[model samples]
Target: MLDDLFPILADPDFQKPGSGLMSFPAYVYVYPPDEEYAFREALPQLQERLRRPNVGQNSLAVNIYDALVEHLEEKTLGGRPLLDRILEQEEQDPEKVDRQVKRHARSEEFVEQVASRFSAFAQEEGGLDRSYVFVHGWGEVHPYLRASQFLDLMEPHLRGYKVVLFYPGTYDNGEFRLFGELSSGNVYRASCLNERLEA
Candidate 1:
């Protein structure tokens, strides 16, 4: 199943994070496990539309967000989602969502750790997808995260990549602030793009 969908990531030719920047709108389409076949069937058509190997230096970054949700073995210590381990509150606590996500994001391998706990496919697929992991940690680390650290470490691997910010419940104070601090033009909002949710 993994081999059929992530050929680009598994192949030997894809660029690593630090080597060079891939073009924008790099779609890291993360689909929870059950949706695998639908996503797999759509890949070639989707890639053909947006991927531009001929345009800009290496623009046209695209990665499929493939994972199994149940593999995470996530459960509530007290009838709440395990994510509360970091949030330290009931899963329904909206205000604490952001705080909790940040509290737990300070690890040296935040995304990798999340993958370990939740998604079994992260490590291998990460390399295949040329994934740029995003994580929050220890109270508002979002504003201070510098890709340079990632770029320094990953340049040798991914060459250039992206790290989207995840704010759990709301998108209040994350990548929006980081991009503003860096004065960059590339910050995007996932909430607005979700047609299923209110914008």
Candidate 2:
């Protein structure tokens, strides 16, 4: 399936930023949970293929895990990274830590931080006109941050740039089921990249 996706990704005309079938320039590439490892291995190759000069586009692959780590580590509590604090808290009170993480992930502050990171990434990659961003590492942030929420908040930032999210789940119509089990709710704006490729 990923073999078929490469061409679409490399095609600047098809994945044209803000000019597709959907109003938003974001897309979700849903795959089975079991293929997670395979997907990870293939990601670099895919990015490399998209970055080739012949592809006629510049590509940037952002791992959500790395982005979240950078964001959280900058947040220090008592001279230690917030992630370190969370780890310690998890050892003593797992449920409490979980609740705190979940709450923070759902907050407007968190969304703004994420949006800032995304904007920086785009600018660093030579702006939206020449960059195609592929985002993965959803599992690392799951339960704490849902794909629906992330995509909804990211829709505005996605304007004028093609951003494809590598989702380990099922997206039927508008609803997204993370890992094909937990419902991340309906993501109405972002089109399914697989569907677009097929069409």
Candidate 3:
């Protein structure tokens, strides 16, 4: 949905030259979904629920499910999601099932590469600030990816700054283990979302 990305896309801080999330696959982030509407009305209190603890089994509200179904309505070159197709073929052929599993594994690898580029160090007026990287692991499959993987992916881009990885862990929660680890010895200037956002 066009409205879905406007908050992150239109912000200059997110669209800056070196640290922009939109810098890679510029169009896909803004992929226009037809019949776009606000999720606030449809999902009701879904956002508030995401901010809570013990959010059982990921209580995905109706609108988010609908949006996902809509995203699958238009298939890309990736084929009709190996998970969906494999489910249908589970009883048909076991060998073909193995192939589908491999495809999904590769897709995840591609996701890691794309997510990596969204990281960079910010420059301060005095000098370079702590090197930081943001791993936008939103959506269903993201929580499965670890914070260390994000930190490793961000390693190359750190350059002169210390690499501090961002991991919005949990299904849709903030488990700042990555930040905590980076700041343990006070070695890096890692901070929470609000702290980093303000910086």
Candidate 4:
């Protein structure tokens, strides 16, 4: 299964216009949540493979979990990280803290921050046109932000680039069921790389 994935990912035409299911080049690679560790273990090797001859200079692998954390840490309220302020309120009102965090997660500010990080990484790592952007860690940033929502927000930023979302979930047809249970919603624009593997 691992061996087959490389050839599919390395295919230069995979991201070209009118390729496969999507008119755009975005893709979702669903895997069982139980196997997240295994996938993480193989991530470096997968990145290395993308840097090999046919795949281009190198791929930009962005763990959105890290991006979100960095964004939260950077955002300060009254000379303290917003998350720290939230932490201070946690004991006094746990529910309020949850709501506040969730609110922040769904904020345009947070979305833009994460998107900026992605674009910066893409630009620094050979730009979108010349490389693949492998996005993962959606599970960690869940409940607050759905994979469907993040991908939807990221669509404009990723217009010309090929993207493979290493989603720890299930995407059948246009519906995405996170962890194979929670319905993340329908997303038809991004092709399913798992389907390509079966093909």
Candidate 5:
């Protein structure tokens, strides 16, 4: 099933305007939560496959975790520097510091910053025909960055490529069950991607 999806991802024909796929340059590959490690380990092979000359054009793959960490390191949160705030919170309340940091991390401003930084990273890779963006480290960011929220904000700026999001979740009956966590709610949906994937 994973291999089947790769051709669709690398095919520029599906990326054209009114190609019957989603307008937004995003697609989701649902997988069992426990298989996350295997899927990540296979990324290099997948990247190699997508890089083949016959795949049509040069493509770039980015692990969002690394991008997010780089963004956090370079930016500030609230009025204080991000790292400084986290350290201060840790000293004042070690147990609750993570929660505090997550709360700040998920702020609209911060999420937009992340989106912007990701766009910049993609642009830096030069003009590629497609981009494969992997959204991992869900456990590390948790409530700070929900997949749906990030995609919704990112859809606007991420254009001109066939972008596939490898989601460790289930897609069923028009809803998304994120990370297989019951508490996370299966009511979420990415309208553009879901409508076509479900078809």
Candidate 6:
């Protein structure tokens, strides 16, 4: 499974900044949901192989799910914890709370803010470099934040590195269908990534 990514991972030109091989400085690696464990196990080896001096010492992988949770815990929107507000209103006013939650979660500003936090994890200690950012955990933050929105917001901040978003979904034609949920229409055709690796 890991063999599928070797071609792109080993390409020196792909690692260079502003190479223009792809419209965006990122790639998509699609894998089955069941392969998540294997993917995690192979991450260290993959990082070791892709590691470059200028990239910094931080781990290559960034779990967006974890980042989102941290953001929710540390910051409050509308002067209150988002989760607490949602839950507090759930019992007395479920519908209203739902509407409020949707308004806050799906807003452009919220998405950009979350995306900014996620992108920060990919940066080098003191500056940026030619590194590989392995992004995962799309499934954890699905309805609240779409993968496409985050990717769009991340484009500007990710130009200096090669980002590989590990999507547990299917890329058919051009649309990426998340978690094989055909009814959801969670299909995203992001033009940012240079290539797609399937497992």
TM-score of 5: 0.72
Q: How do the residues 1-199 of candidate 1 rate in per-residue lDDT, one tens digit apiece? A: 2223234332234335432235431222223334445544554444443233431111221121111122122535577655445344545675675554434333345444443432232244421343334332212233223232322322323324543322222223323223223421223422222222222
lDDT of 2 by residue, 8-108 (tens): 77666775664674577777899998999999888887776766667756667778767777767887888988988888788899999989888777667
Worst 10 residues of 6 by lDDT: 183-192
**What value does the lDDT take at residue 162 in candidate 2?**
71
Top model number, lDDT = 2
Q: Write the per-residue lDDT of candidate 6 for residues 99-197, one digit (tens) a residue.
A: 775565555666577556545655537443435667788777676556776667566656556666888776666677788663224334343232444
What value does the lDDT take at residue 68 in candidate 6? 61
Candidate 5 structure quality by residue, lDDT tens digits, 150-172: 67766665654445566676676
Runs in model 1 lying further than 4 Å from the true structure: 1-75, 83-99, 114-199
100-174 per-residue lDDT for model 4 (tens digits): 877877777877876676566556744334456788888987877777777777766664456778888887767
Candidate 3's C-alpha runs over 4 A off are 1-139, 157-190, 196-199
Model 2 vs. true fold: TM: 0.87
* C-alpha lDDT values of all predictions: 0.33, 0.76, 0.32, 0.74, 0.59, 0.62
Error of 3 at 134 (Å): 6.1
- In model 6, the Cα lDDT at residue 92 comes to 98
Report how far residue 160 has shifted in candidate 1, in Å. Answer: 11
Q: Could you tell me every candidate's TM-score relative to the true structure?
A: 0.29, 0.87, 0.28, 0.86, 0.72, 0.71
Give the TM-score ranking, best first: 2, 4, 5, 6, 1, 3
Best by TM-score: 2
Which segments of candidate 2 are over 4 A away from where they belong? 125-129
